[model samples]
Target: MTKNELGIQAMQKGNFEEAAKYFSEAIEENPTDPLLYVNFGNLLAALNDHERAIRFFEKAIEIDSNTATAYYGAGTVSYNKNDFVKAKDFFEKAMKNGLESSDLFFMFGMTFIQLEQPRLALPYLQRAIELNEKDIDARFQYGLCLAQFGQMEEAKKELSIVVEQEPNHSDAYYNLGVAYAYEENIDKALSMFNKALDIQPDHLLAGNAKKLIEEAINR
Candidate 1:
C-alpha cells in the first residue's frame, strides 16, 4: 500500500505516531506533490500542532496556488486559532478557487457571525442549510442570526426544528424561550426556559431568564 494510504489507516486506528511517521515518509518520497503537504498539514492539525500545520498548508499553497484544499486547510486552522479575519480571507479564497461544500459554507457563515456581522452571515448560513438541512449546528446558528436580525418568528421555526430533532438540546430550548419572550408570550417563554433548565440545571442564562420572567409575572 502507498505510504499515504497507510498513514490514513494509522490515523483511523488512533496510532498518531505511526500516522505521522507514514505521512512524513510520504512527504519525503513525494516532495513536490501539493496533496502530500496538504495531507501532512491535516495530520499535524489533528495533533494540535497548529504552527507546523500552517507551514505545511503554506507549502502546499506555494507549490500549487490554484488548489482550494490548501486554502481551506489554512482557513480551518486559523478558525481554530481564533484568527477570524485570516480565516475569512482564506475561506473566501477557497471559494474563489472552487472549493464548495456544506462545511465550507458553514465555516464562512460562522466567521461572519464571529465578526458580529449577522446580516452578512445569513445568506451563507442559508446556503449551508440548503446543502445539508440535517445539520443541527448550522440550523441553530441560522436561527440565532435570524433572531439577531429581529426575525423572531423565523428564528422560532428553525430553533423549534432543532429541539424536535434533538430533544436534549438545552440551548435550543433556551433560544426558543427567547423567541417567545420577544413575541410577548410570557407564559410560553417561561415554560421553554423551565424545560431548558430541566435539561441543564446549571444553564445560567436560562436560570436567569426564568427568574426574570417569574418576577415580571408576580409584579
Candidate 2:
C-alpha cells in the first residue's frame, strides 16, 4: 500500500518507470529516510545509471553514515563498473557498519580474486560456502582458490560436490580434471576431461587437455 512497497513490487516485475516514479514519490514524502535513498540507488544501479546511483548512495550516507545498506549498494555499483578497489573498500566499510551475509562475503572474495589476491580471497569464500552451501558459484570459486594454493585434494572435493549437484556443469568437470592431472592420476584426469567435453564439445581447454593426456599416455 505504501509508495515504497509499490515501488519494490514494480522493481520485482521489471517495470522500471513505475518503480522510479513510486521511489521518487516516496523520497519526496520522506526526504530524510536513508532507506528510501538506498532503495532508489539500487534502482538506478539496476538501470545501469551507475553515476546517479552512487550519488543517491552518497546522499544516503550523508543522511546516515552508519547505513550499511547504502555502502553495500555503492559497492555493488563499483563492482559492476569493474572498480574492484573501490568495491572492496566499500564492502569492507559495510562490514564495519555491521553488515554480514553470504552475498557480501562472496562479493568480498570475488573482489579479492579479481585483484589477484587469491590468498586473501580464501577465507571470505570459505565463509561464504559455509553460510550457503548450495551456492554453486561460490563453491566453484572456493575450489579454484584452493587449487591456486596447491590444496588439490580440497579443490577436488569442492569441485566434485559441484559436479554431483549439477551433473551438466562442464567447468566443474574441467576443473576436477585439472586437479586429477595435478595429482598425476592421468586416467582419471582423462575421463574427467572427456566428461567435460561431452557436456560442452566446444570447451577448448577441455578438448586440449584431453588431447595432451592422450599423447602423453601414448608416449
Candidate 3:
C-alpha cells in the first residue's frame, strides 16, 4: 500500500505515532503532493498539535492553492483555537474550492454561531442536515438556530424529532419546553421541562423555567 494509505490506516487504528511516521515518510517521498501534507495536518490536529497542524495545512495550501482539504484542516485548527474569524475565512475558501461535505457545512455553520451570526448559520446548518440526516448534533444546532430566528414551529418540529431519535437529550427537551412556552401552552411546556429535569437533574435552565412557570401560576 502507498505510504499515505498506510498512514491513514494506522491513524484509523489509533496508532498515531505509527501514522505520523508513515505520513512523514510519505511527505518525504512526495514533497509536492498536497494530500500528504493535508493528511499530516489531520494527524497533527488529532494529536492536539494545533500550531503544527496549521503549518502543515498551510504547506498543503502553498503547494496547491486549490486544495480544499488544506483549507478545511486550517479552518478546523482555527476553530479549535477559537479563532472564529480565521476559521470562517478558511471554511469559505474551502467551499469556494469545491469542498462539499456535511462536516464542512456543519463547521461553517458553527463558526457563524460563534461569531454571533445565527442568521448566516441557519442555511449552512440546514444544508448539513440535508446532507447527513443521521447527524444528531447538526440537527440539534439547526433546530436551535431556527429557534433563534423565532421560527418556533419549525424549531419544535426539529426538536421533537431530536427527542424522539435520542430520548436522553435533555437540551432538546428544554428547547421543546421553550417552544411550547412561546406558544402559550403552559401545561405542555411544564411537562417538557419536567422531562428535561428527569433526564438531567442539574439542568439549571429547565429547573428555573419550571419554577418561574409555577410562580406565575400562583401569582
Candidate 4:
C-alpha cells in the first residue's frame, strides 16, 4: 500500500505517531499532492493540533484552490474553535469547490444556526437530511429550525419521527411536547413532557413545562 494509505490505516487504528510518520514521509515523497496535505491536516486536526492542521489545509489550498476537502478541514477546525464566521466562509468555499457531502451540508447548516440565522440554516439542514435520512442529529436540528420558524406541525412531524427512530431521545420528546403545547393539545403535550422526563429525569425544561400545564389545568 502507499505510504498515505498506510498513514490512513494507522490513523484509523489510533496510532497517531505512526500515522504522522507515514504521512510525513508521504508528503516528502509527494509534496505536490494536495490530498497528502489534506490527510495530514485531518490527522493533526484529530490530535487537536489546530495550528498545524490549519497550516496543512492552507498548504493544500495553496497547491490546489479547488481542493474541497482542504476547505472542509479548515472549516471544521474553525467550527471547533467556535469561529463560526470563518467556518461559514470555508464551508461555502468547499461547496463552491463541489463538495456536496451530507457532512458538509450539516456543518454548513450548523454554522448558520450558530450565526443565529435559522432561516438560512433550514435549507442546508433539509439538504443534509435528504442526503442521509438516517442522520438523527440532522433531523433533530431540522425539526428545531422548523419550530423556530413557528412551523409547529412540521416540527412535530419531524420530532415524532426522531422519537420513533431513537426512543430514548429525551430532547426530541421535549420538543414534541412544546409543539403539542403550541397546538393547545394539553394531554398529548403532558404525555410527551412525561416521556422526556422519564428518559432524562433532570430535564429542567420538561419539568417546568409539566408544572405550567398542571397549573393551567388547576386554574
Candidate 5:
C-alpha cells in the first residue's frame, strides 16, 4: 500500500504513531499534495499539538491557496487554543472560500460567545438552528444567548421548542427555567426546574432552583 493509504488506515485505526510516521514519509515523497498536509495536520490536531497542526494547515494553504478545508483546520486549532480573534479571522476566510455547514456556523457562534460578542453570535447560531433544527446543543445554546441579550421572549420560544423536542434534557430544562425566571414567570420557572431535577437528580443548578422556588413560596 502507498504511504498515504497506510497513513489513512492507521489514522482510522487510532494508531497515531504509525499514522504520523506514514504521513511524514508521504510528505517527503509528495510534498506538493495539499491532502498530505491536511492529513498530517489532522493527526497532529487529534494529538493536541495545535501549534504544529496550525503550521501544517498553513503549509497546505500555501500549496493550494484556495482549499477551504485548510482554512477551517487553522480556524479550529486557533479556536481550540482559545484565540477567538484568530479563529474568527480564519473562519471568515474559510466561509468566503466556500465552506458551508451548520457546524461551521455553530463554531463561529461559540467563538463569538468567547469573545463576549454574543449579540453578534446570535445570527450565526440562529442560522445553525435553521440549518439543523434537530441539534439540541445548537438550540439550547442559541436560547441561552438570546436570554443573555435580554431577548427573554424570543429566548422563551426557543427554549420551549427544545423542551418539546426532548422532555428529559436536563440542561434544556434548566436553561428554559432561567428564561422563564427572566420573564417573571415564576411558576413556570419552578415547574421547569423541578422537571430538570427529576431528569438529573444530582444537578446542582436544578437543586438550587428548587430551593429558590420553595423560599419564594414560603415568602
Candidate 6:
C-alpha cells in the first residue's frame, strides 16, 4: 500500500504514532508535497509535542506560505501555552490567508477572553453563533462572556435557551442559578440549583447550592 494511503488509514484509527511514521516515509519519497508536513504536524500536535509540531508546521508554511492550516496549528499551540498575543497573531494570520469558520472565530474569542478582553470576545462569539446556531458549547461560552462583561440579562437569555433546549444540562442550570441569585430572585435561584442537582447529582456547584438553599429555608 502507498505510504500516504497507509498514513491516512492510521490517522483515521487514532494511531498518530503510526500515522507520523508513514507520513515521514511518504515525505522521504515525496519531499515537495506540503500535505505531508500538514499530516505530520497534525499528528505531533495531537500528541502535544508542541516543539516538533511547530517545526512541521513551519515546513508546511515554507512549502506554501498561503496554507492556513500551518498558521492555525502554530496558533493553537501558542494558545495552549497561554501566549495569547502570539496566539492572536497566528490566528489572525490564518484568517487573512484562508481560514474562516465558526470554530476558528470562537477560538479567537476564547483567546481574547484569556487576555481579559471580553469586549473583543463578544463580536467573534456573536459571529460564531450567527454562523452556526446549533453549537451548544459556543452558546454556553457566549453566555459566559456576557456574564463576565456584566451583561447579566443577555447572558441569562443565552443560558436559558440552553436549559430549554437541553433540560438536563447541569451547567446551564447552574449558570441560571447564578444569574438569578445576582438578580435577587432567591426562589428562582434555589429552583435552578435543585434542577441542576436533579440532572447531575455529583455536580459540585449544585451540591453546594443545595446546601445553601436548604440552609436558607431552615432560617
lDDT (10s digit) by residue, model 3, range 6-81: 9999999999999999999998888999999999999999999999999999999999999999999999999999
Please write out the lDDT profile of model 4 over residues 1-219, one tens digit for every residue.
999999999999999999999999999998999999999999999999999999999999999999999999999999999999999999999999999999999999999999999899999989999999988999999999999889998999899889889999999999999999998999999999999999999999999999999999999
lDDT of 3 at 11: 99
Determine which window of 10 residues in candidate 5 has minimal summed lDDT.
175-184
Q: What TM-score fits each model?
A: 0.96, 0.97, 0.97, 0.97, 0.87, 0.86
Model 1: which residue pairs collide? none
Clashing residue pairs in candidate 2 are none
The alpha-carbon deviation from the true structure for residue 22 of candidate 5, after best TM-score superposition, in angstroms, is 3.8
lDDT at 153, model 1: 89
| lDDT tens digits, residue span 92-125, model 2 | 9999999988899999999999999999999999
Candidate 5 residue-wise lDDT at 159: 84
- Indicate the residue-level lDDT of 187 in model 6: 90
Q: Per-model C-alpha lDDT, please?
A: 0.93, 0.95, 0.96, 0.97, 0.89, 0.87
Cα-based RMSD of candidate 6: 2.4
lDDT of predicted model 5: 0.89
- Lowest summed lDDT across 10 adjacent residues in model 6 is found at 205-214
lDDT over C-alpha atoms for residue 200 of model 6: 90
Candidate 5: C-alpha RMSD after superposition: 2.3
Write down the worst ten-residue block by lDDT for model 1: 35-44
Per-residue lDDT of candidate 5, residues 1-219 (tens digit): 999999999999999999999999999999999989989998999999998999999999999988788888888999999999999998898899898888888888888999999998998899889999987778888999988889888888888889899988888889888878867788988988989989999999988987987898899
lDDT of 4 at 63: 98
Structural RMSD, model 1: 1.2
